[model samples]
Target: MPSVPLHSSATPIVSAVLAFDVGGTDTKAGLVLSAAPGEVPEIVDIQRFRTALDAQRPGPVLVDFLDGLLRRYATEHPQLRIAAVGVTVPGLVDEQRGIGIYAANLGWRDYPFRAELESRMQLPVSFGHDVGAAGDAEVALGAGQGAENAMILVVGTGIAAALYIDGRRLRAGGYAGEVGHAMAPAPDGGLQIMEATGSAGAIGRRYLLAHPDFSGGAREVLTLAKAGDTVAQRIWAEAIAALAFSIAQAVAMIGISKVVIGGGLAEAGDELFEPLAKQIDQLLSFQPRPVLVKAMLGQNAGLIGSALKAQELLSAASSEPSTGALP
Candidate 1:
């Protein structure tokens, strides 16, 4: 139920792009009035609001929340006309259709997001998979920039990845990069789920569940392992091993030359990267070794990516001759 403030300006009206990074817990919105390519979007403003996505009817809740945000944003910058609006959401998105196919976190299915928002806001809209958008932002502006072949892995509430090959973003029906759910060979000699064993949330949760007395994050687990906490050490090592397996698989398949890791778990820094690199290195002799690096954009990657998408859409809309929807 929060509202943003509007500001009035006498300056000549300028084209603007609005981008929203809609998450289960929080929503980030940015308004970029103008900027050149390769320059940071001139952010007029950025705001974050709590998302009530836990409601039984999350679709409407989210829609209303977005509408309210946009309304406030528009009210503030009435002089500036919006060229495009880009929304990034977590789910199996139909980017072409601008529909939220299925989001377990948001409880949305087949929602016609693009048409709905366009009708409500009366502007061009672009939709993208949340993580994929983040990957695009990274490749275009952050850690993966200039890499011909690279992968961006974000390990947060869940594990998701984005692939960039030769400057083209790969989207295999919005199902291309789901590395977290991939089944991994258990380092403990049993089948283990990748996210369950490798994600930062999973690593911390598993350890805490097993050892209620321990208090810390994935990094603490690694520290405990170094100090001889058998259970902690085992879980930490297992997670690293599982991660390496996934990276090596990606390397072999895509011939990825670089891998950028981000998200909450990635905060472990060398504790995560060094060990993961070693494991992946030891696994393959001839397969080209992918340079593993941490994500540079951090939490803002999604917002930045969404803004870039908005900018791209705005640019595209300016060029394409407008016509009625094609059957």
Candidate 2:
């Protein structure tokens, strides 16, 4: 876990907020209370629940589960009032509209997520994409902090990126950072998406395709590569090359000063970063090379980001005049 930073001595403490990060397999909830006003909130009562298995009816089930979690939290902490609620979910999310456009893993489509949650909970709701929210947290408090421009890439089952430039997140209507789908040179002398060649899932599939007798995943393939397996080495090298190509392209296009990589594969540490940095260096001529760093927040980044969003909602509401009307 990354160390939480303290606020300046001048600010005072404020109210609490509720936050949830809904993932494909699990949902994490936290109550965030500020140690001081205008400071990073201290997260408390953090809990994780398994996501509903009924994909056919996940929306209602998820909403009910969230309601239950919130109720339990409120009951336990009667002294703390939740000003707003923030929820981050995986998939094609329209944060501005608070609609879950599509989530193949969670099996939902065009769900009015924010409205439903707010209607039931009677609180302001902040909804956003999981990766985007995580990136925001990274920029605000983790690896990408202090950089004027940066790209945070989460390489898990699939690959995606959160682009930050000029002190602002470039959402581009939620379609801007789909780096996995970007075109790259395929092994067969044709164009292919970066995820199809370099993602963890892709690496596993490639290994299986080359050696049908093997029954291991990407981790095993990587171990074999390190131990001098020719096929594993070739597959790993190709994936690295494709990823480097994509990073070089991003650097050329955005002039990002930093690239923070997270997720399971980043655990490889030097093995992944050293080669990737070298490849990117070789690929770029006059372009300034971006420094590559590992993610500092681990898996809790999305949850922290949700808390930040909740705080943002609180701030916005505080600035608005009370109409004696409910949203």
Candidate 3:
């Protein structure tokens, strides 16, 4: 049987949640309706906007873009009232205070994103880390839905992981996940960092640089290996080994029951997961083997997760006992 496509609907919920997944180059926006705690929520509307966060005034530029989007959403769907908003952004985020502490690519520091959105739309808002939000989405509706404990490692241009113990997220001052940045002995036996040698992005770049004759990219590297390119094969093997090393160590230390991987590199499918699982199994002698799986949600996981977080905030605000605004 073929997989069914999830179609967006406009069914009204007790409270509607508007979500945004802001990235370095693009921003994804969506709305969740008819949501509840632990419910398999659905996105009512989803759209994307170009966001060149690499510019200088990324905050104001993003602010204007969001402002326009919100107004358009309201005008297009006059029947649905947005009860709350959630925005997930890359970089070090202080979600508790709704601040984007530092976004290297976006050039943001101590950005008050939640306040800006709330003020503009006069609605409650929530903020979250991009990878962490995606991880949360996986835990709620993807691979870790029924698990007691789950670790979601997002392997992309960079690496990060989200730790879910029980139903709650673990935010260690908003810096709990930075797996790619973890320093490891350089594969070349030099002073290079772990990510320089380990991440899927690094693997692709390394392979391409070493062999200009080969087209560059993760998929290209996999193809080259399949065609028996010795260097490509060695690079691919080392990349998988590095990931397995990191994951194995994480399993031993965190006692995670399930691991879901997402990101650009994860696109290699079983080519990446099968080898990773085997390597991890071989490496971990005493630790229990955690089930490793690909993320059910694709690149849009962050957007979906942000929508869920917004939905939660919306529900919370709608149910709270009324209190008069302080003069």
Error of 3 at 12 (Å): 8.9
lDDT for each residue of candidate 2 in 232-324, tens digit (9 for 90 to 100):
998888888888989999999988779999877788788899999999999898999999999988888888888888778777777788733
List the candidates' TM-scores in order.
0.88, 0.86, 0.87
Residue range 67-112, candidate 1, lDDT tens digits: 8888889889877777778889997887878888888878988888
**Alpha-carbon deviation at 68 in model 3, angstroms:** 1.7
Task: Give, for candidate 3, the lowest lDDT window spanning 10 residues.
Answer: 7-16
Residue range 134-230, candidate 3, lDDT tens digits: 9988888887788777889888777788887666677877787777777655676654455676687888889878877766777888888989999
**Whole-model lDDT for model 3 versus the true structure?**
0.78
Q: Report the C-alpha displacement of residue 151, candidate 1, in angstroms.
A: 0.8
lDDT of model 1 at residue 167? 76
Superposed by TM-score, candidate 3 places the C-alpha of residue 55 at a distance from the truth, in angstroms, of 4.9
The C-alpha RMSD of each candidate to the native structure, in angstroms, is 6.0, 6.9, 6.8
Q: What is the C-alpha lDDT of each candidate?
A: 0.82, 0.85, 0.78
